[model samples]
Target: MATKKTSSKEAHHATLDGEDEDATHALELLAGKIGEPPRSSLQAILAGTTDADLVSVGKTILSSRIVTDAARIYRKAWDFYQEASDEQRKRLRGFSKPLLAVAVQQALALEQLDRKLAAKSTSAGVARAAHEKAAEAAQSRAIELRDQAYDALRDAAGRDEGLRAQVDAAFGTATTSETLARGLEQTAKLLRAWLGSDDEALTARLGLANLDDSYAKELATAAKDVRNAAANATNRPADGKVTQGALDRADGINVLIMGQILRAFEGAHGIDPTIPRLVPISTRRLFNRKTKKKAGEIQPPQNGNGPQPTGDGETLSDG
Candidate 1:
């Protein structure tokens, strides 16, 4: 008589029963707080991690300030959605999927929060758009990873009865990758903000000992000349020196420093600089540099000329 062999399915089930029970209890606790779908998705990820990695991610989800921040944003979006007029909601939906009103509301919240935080730091060189873009990229990647995990769980569930409940919990009604991704992205942004350093501070730490070369002197002289030229240019300089053509030809560096640097140049001659000086330019050339680099390959410097020790810091404003 031939005996039936214990199949792989049987083996998996036999081993997973205890594991599944533990996972289920953990899922219940997380689901109560953050919803079952994302919690299940988190479980899927945690299942593949070692004890150390699992502990780390668990702390991030549970203890990070950004997680609370994201939750607040989500609550605000939900409230806004509930209060919105039907016609406005309909118009918003026409703009995009996954409920446009919620999307825009959350986006605006994220942008405002990013700006507010960056403003508190010596991050004058860091653009608000840069942080927003970083968060968006993080969200996109997190969503992609979560969907992949869900799909794998679904395929496994097709063959194993034990995994079917997990699949259901992850992909059941009202569960969307977009929601999970937003939370994941907010955590990422907060992590990035904490890890980021101010470039000017770093430079000051490194010291200017290497900047005593003739090239440095020449560069400083050139910058001063350009500043003066930009400050005095009605069309061209009276000394027949080459002034910047128009706003269209000037780069971001030129625009930021031309008027202010020119003011400092006058201060050298005992002329006190005033606020709200104007630069003459008909066209403005904005920074639109593009590259083929991957995200995280390069990061923008997080530094700028903050208030000097003598409290003589200049504030540049648009007219």
Candidate 2:
């Protein structure tokens, strides 16, 4: 039998078809295209494995001011159009006037919040109530616009079955991109809180708060270095613009931060622990003793009571 090598395109398609590793890679690629914070946040949300995860993810999505603003715009337009007489709606330009109206509403709501905020002086209580009401309405509109977008995309997909996957991927990318961006911002806030206080009870419990001043400063400095390096690395030109040394430096800092994030995550409870691993290129390398260090050194088994390797690379049985 001949061994068949899968092409990169085929592998990517496989991810859409449900291969775990490839799907994860596809998501990572999607995040990269979407940009940082959102990408990591999106990955974390996707990796969520419990009810608590869902709740955290939900809050992240709901609290996105951008999404809320977009929703409000669509809702305001929809509401205005709904109140219009049939003749008035007909007077609006375009064949798909209704759809155009919905899209315009999305754009319009960008300024809606500002206008509402500016109304604060006339009557504080009334302004607050109106603001809340507007947010609720906007949220509803956003949902409606979302449904409309889905319907349009799906309807087109039905006509061209071959494009279904593309359509679905596009829709998924857009929705997840927004959610991920919002989640990333939230995650940043959480990180700042964690690193802000040396006497924090949680840090104390984790035995991190007791670290000597020098060690703590070193850890903090390493984090800052990693962050700066990452920003530079990601912004590098695709046409071989950045030097190899710069890339290597970024890689080194990444390894440093990975350790810090994992250590912190293992001790915390409020956020998803595995979210750190979602950072772009944040992969753990398994120890390959055969290739590095000694050729004959024994390695301990991670699980099961299987025969262990002895010194000089021979297998030994304890039983």
- Winning candidate number (TM-score): 1
lDDT by residue (78-177, candidate 1, tens digit) is 4444565564344332221222223222323322332333333323224344544554554454455445444543443345554445444543221333
In terms of lDDT, the poorest run of 10 residues in model 1 is: 307-316
- Score candidate 1 by TM-score against the native: 0.18
Worst 10 residues of 2 by lDDT: 278-287
TM-score of 2: 0.17
Query: What is the Å distance of residue 95 in model 1 from its true position?
Result: 63
Residue 196 deviation, candidate 1, in Å?
38
lDDT of 1: 0.30
Score every model by TM-score. Answer: 0.18, 0.17
